[model samples]
Target: MNCVLCLIENDPIAIFGLKKMLEKTNYVKQLEVYEDGEQALHKLKPHLIENTPRTPDVIFLDLNMPIMDGWEFIEAYTAIDRPQNAKKILLYVVTSSVMQRDRDRACELSAVTGYIVKPVTKDDLKHVFEEDLQELWKNQ
Candidate 1:
């Protein structure tokens, strides 16, 4: 249950709500927060130098932000020359965008783990866990 996660969001209310839901799972260990994708990139880039457990297990990325949006982040992140063992972030597009186009766009991105619409509840988190995190949990 030592799932380290990150939240790259600008709105304080959304951050608080997401944090509250994540806390309820009792799975997340370190929950890092960034105001934008730029901040997240700045902090996470160095970790890509090598496969390190210090990196986050999952990143709940918002599509829209003040500086450097999700698409920009995905482009930047995928460009990095990561070592083979480096733990690639399981990036999930967590957004309010309900348009089919948005989901299709997210699906087109190879780096994206999945697309999740907000306000993300505990059930959503549970479903995500069931998808892959359950295997990780069992192995742990």
Candidate 2:
């Protein structure tokens, strides 16, 4: 089955651009966009709690946003109690920030799988899926 992806970003242009780029890939079957971390956490909680099949397989998070930022979202999400066998969600920090601190901070978070600078290319998305598929195969 194809994968589902979630995007937590506020910039409309970035959202539009990502949607276009993601559309170019064949593995993504669904894309959910959240304006900020709070909204994302609220909306995603049920699926997460239930361990639903619709739970996103991947999340592309942005650092800057109104109300709740990516950092806050990561904190909150990681705090949630999840089943040991719950579907894994690979979260990538997709932001314009190139600061070493930002990269280091992202790496410190266990929930974060990778970090991508702004304007994620189609190849990046492809690589993420390929890596995920490889992981799944290894586990099986």
Candidate 3:
């Protein structure tokens, strides 16, 4: 299976850890990391404009960043017009913030499929890939 994964965060360590976790997973083939939401959005826009099939399959977004936070990223991502075959994109909010408001806001986004806390582990990825992802795969 072909899949694209994106990690957007200002922290390099967090990005590296998430990328490593995904690398150990069976589903992810390509992974992209961005330091901020604006950079991610800028990079993704051209791909969307070209109707690129390589657009990320899943996005792990951080609530806080130097430029354009996760909320802004969601707004931009949702506004983009993608091709029919562009990939089944799932957005997951992965952040250190434990505030209920943040969690609630993340869940409120239509594009967001799940919310995960910081220090994501292989087990978490496994559950998402094996269990939650099964429904989407079956539909596909």
Candidate 4:
């Protein structure tokens, strides 16, 4: 099975660019994009009641989004039981904010596997392929 990915980012340029990048990769079979964290959470909530293939193996989350922010999603998601597919989901905080507080807060969230600065590069994505993240992409 190929790996599935999701991006919850409000920036159009960033979403388009990241989608294009993932399309060029060999492993990523699907890419789901959400304009805001709330939309992503709403879609993900259903997985708790029923099985779904839409759950992403890895998530690229933006801290600042309309409706619900990344932190809010993290809180809500963790407050309830997580779906099986989402159990190992690696949610990365991909944001432009370099503030120490934001980074610190993101790291504090159990759902957040890593915190990435804006303009995520090919090297960064490649690095994700290494280390403990190998388990997430390997399942597919």
Candidate 5:
């Protein structure tokens, strides 16, 4: 199933590369890119609260940004009182950081689905979908 996706990142090259890769896979029906965490949180909060279909199915978040870093976003986002009927949003920490501490910290969050290193590869993308597919099939 195609999904609506959000990418919160500061680097133009990273955005372009991810956009291109997503396009090639045809897995994303919509992609919203935010330059920083504050923008994403601000823009997505309303949709999430309203339980709109426009709400992203997946979010790729970067740890480092100019304003409102990923950690801050997570704290604020988790605090939001989303409707129970709202779609399940899968959040993934996608960053250049290879630090074990970073990975451990990200994984500690219940909202976060997985963590991927920067320059996301086809294999990583495939794995994301594969996990979703497995869940979908199981439900069916």
Candidate 6:
């Protein structure tokens, strides 16, 4: 249940809503919100370097942002020397983008666990927890 949830979106309302939903959830212990991928990446580096528990367990990345979009973030993240804890980290493309190309690209990444549409609800989080997180933990 000890986990970090990262959200990178320019919209404050969306971030707030997601944070509220996460607060209602049982699984997530800690949640981290970022207005842009650049900031998230900057803070994430220290956690990766220290191999700390503050590192995110799941990253809810957005395709659009002011600086460093989800694709760019993933590229940069992949280039770094991910810590042992980071190896278990799951990246999910949580965006409003309904484009097939985006979905296809997201699915192509081995680190990405799933691609989810925007306006993520508690039910969506529940499904992700049950279907993906549970399976991942079981396998590990």
Q: What's each prediction's TM-score?
A: 0.91, 0.94, 0.88, 0.87, 0.93, 0.90
Q: Clashing residue pairs in candidate 5, if any?
A: none
Whole-model alpha-carbon lDDT for candidate 1: 0.83
Off by over 4 Å in 2: none
Over the stretch 1-140, how does candidate 3's per-residue lDDT look in tens digits?
Answer: 46677778898888777767666666787778888999999988877666466577678899898869889989988998877776677789999998999899889889999999988988778777677667677888
- Model 6 shows how many backbone clashes? 0
lDDT (Cα, tens digit) per residue for candidate 1, span 41-73: 998888767655667888889999978998898
Residues 1-140, candidate 2, lDDT per residue (tens digit)?
47888899999999999888777767779889999999999999988877776799889999999998999999999999988878877899999999999999999999999999988987788778887655964685
lDDT of each: 0.83, 0.88, 0.81, 0.79, 0.88, 0.81
Candidate 6 residue 1 C-alpha distance from true site, Å: 2.3
In model 3, the worst 10-residue window by lDDT is 48-57
Summed backbone clashes in each candidate are: 1, 0, 0, 1, 0, 0
Q: Weakest 10 consecutive residues, lDDT, candidate 4?
A: 129-138
Deviation in Å, model 5, residue 106 alpha carbon: 0.7
Best by TM-score: 2
Flag regions of model 6 displaced more than 4 Å: 83-87
For candidate 4, give the lDDT of residue 138: 61
RMSD of each: 2.0, 1.3, 1.8, 2.4, 1.6, 1.7
What is the per-residue lDDT of model 6 for residues 33-113, given as tens digits with 9 covering 90 to 100?
787778988988887666566877778888898888888888887887865644477788899999999999899988788
What ordering of candidates by TM-score runs from best to worst? 2, 5, 1, 6, 3, 4
Ranking the candidates on lDDT from highest down gives 2, 5, 1, 3, 6, 4
lDDT at residue 72 of model 1 (Cα atoms): 95
